[model samples]
Target chain A: MADHKTKASAKTSSPSGGEEAYVPPALANLIGYYLRIAQEASFQAIRQGTGKSDLKPGWYTLLTILSENPGVTPTELSKLCGRDRSTLTSTLNGLDARGLIARRRKAGDQRSYGVKLTAAGEAMLRKLQVIARAHDERLDAIVGKDKPLLMTLLRRIVDELGNGYPPPPARGLGKTSRTR
Target chain B: MADHKTKASAKTSSPSGGEEAYVPPALANLIGYYLRIAQEASFQAIRQGTGKSDLKPGWYTLLTILSENPGVTPTELSKLCGRDRSTLTSTLNGLDARGLIARRRKAGDQRSYGVKLTAAGEAMLRKLQVIARAHDERLDAIVGKDKPLLMTLLRRIVDELGNGYPPPPARGLGKTSRTR
Candidate 1:
């Protein structure tokens, strides 16, 4: 750590000092502020955990979705994840290129298709499940009470916020380097 | 809504069907998972509430910190906010451009300087505090407990994560449009 600091200092400047965590007076209680902190923590954990994998940030969540909702279509997947379909496409393309997922057109509907986990995709998700479990355990240590109470609260916010937001048709063929 | 769908469909080919929110298998329990959902909600709420203001998603939080820790330097503010100084420069520059913040070097301390809320900065924060308060009240309605418990749990997670992440020095001069 000290060595890195010295190297970094040599490149530009000295270390920033006197950083007592300032819980922004009222911002801490604003729900959004805490949400950013917690989400950033989760993002970091995923980045660290999947550092060696080809999977992008938030792709594990997509894989988990495909694992649970096997045979789900891209549109369905988008709605399930609340991510725009344009966003889902690039992610889908990457996982597809890696042989982790397979896309199959529905028998009658040629334009739309179902997304399935290839054997490799399922295998990757299983490994991620373990890492995710560890992440959950770490959070469990902090949140306590198994998180149902907290989830219950968060779910309520999602429910109320979901109202009146139009679901859009997803654009096809976009780059999918999801950065969490 | 229909028009958006029509336009989107025209571009995308067809409507995607069957998007029930897929609860991520076993990950719904992770505090981070809940954190993403909760954060998205707060983000949407802020988008709705402050749609007219030039304040970007996170600038409000930065402003709140400066409001609380008046006369803090870039290094100290970086520490207080758990962000690298290099990351803070653009954000500081933006607020400074808006005439909401001021920075000055300390006597005998050429490198370190203090950041204070300009009267405009204070006034904007005061206005934002009201909007932020109303945002909190809506969340409080959803969380049902005014967030002491939730904030405490999240703070714990932030504290645990803060350790081991090296603080970097703030770069001298650059564009400071920090998105995350």
Candidate 2:
């Protein structure tokens, strides 16, 4: 389906030439848009640095999760990453085929599988980290001295948007109970 | 091809218990993931509030652009919206079918068309503004006072990425000009 969607739109030279268009001023202030652009920049940087390695950002993510939490089940990882089981299944299969990771059935749950990184996976992740760091540093450099301010703002937004912490207490409310 | 892909996936799911899977942490913090989630949230909010109206976020963006820049060209709007000409072509068809906007051939350029919102489009945009405001407020509510911070961070990221901006300044030893 994705392939068809891509192919169907592949013939178009430009994606935005049309009449009666709608533009949102708020888009300029959108965090989501910023994140998207940054990620794309990071991806491009990594791809260039690595000479177009087959490993995608998704593959790196899977490798990281397995490295951090050995014996983690696919279900647990899916919830953490907010992907559907089917998508994870395919990703796992691909990674396994590449011999970067291995999946074995859990002892008690016959239906469930435990995922872990292979030695090659660790080596790749370590190498990729350099690229990721360089990407992040470049992102920081682009913002200049304002990098800290920007990160602070993003963290605040993340907290506010339920991406991380809960909202602060309402105005004039008594001391809020701690809920981490 | 899309149908075939869907069918194949469906067949696999029928036999499985549809168990949930995990996503790796490496991909979790990528900008694309956050952008996708944010877009999904905004889309869902729009759908929930204006499902019967058949309005879409893309259409709302078009109306806003036209409202801001009256008599904007289709090609210009397409560039601003970051969508391909083909998709914009179909989108314009739908908007025109609803009588929400009108397009006229440019006086000088045979290939270009100037776009404007109709009275109906203006009215619809006005109504959508209320719903959009509510959604924005909800988004704001989520972030609370952190919105300013989030906006700052987002702007920094955007600036660094050069996603909506022109190419980065040439690397040299000189004080950089600041433009917001």
| Top lDDT prediction, candidate number | 1
Relative to the true structure, candidate 2 has a C-alpha RMSD (angstroms) of: 11.3
lDDT of 1: 0.68
Candidate 1 C-alpha lDDT tens digits along B98-155? 9999898898799778999999998888777777778777777777763788777777
DockQ of all models, two decimals each: 0.29, 0.13
Q: What's model 2's lDDT at B1? A: 12
Per DockQ, the best of the predicted structures is 1
Give the alpha carbon lDDT tens digit for every residue of B1-180 in model 2: 112123222321211112222324554444433443454444444555675667675576678777877787766675566553456778888888999889989999898888889999899888877777776766666666767766666555544443322222223422321111
Badly placed stretches (over 4 Å) of model 1 are A1-4, A7-20, A164-180, B1-22, B165-180
Question: Alpha carbon lDDT of residue B13, candidate 1?
Answer: 18
Any idea what lDDT model 2 has?
0.57
Candidate 1 chain A, poorest ten consecutive residues by summed lDDT: A11-20
Instruction: Give the CA lDDT, 0 to 100, for residue B68 in model 2.
Output: 79
Q: Interface RMSD (Å), each candidate?
A: 9.8, 14.5
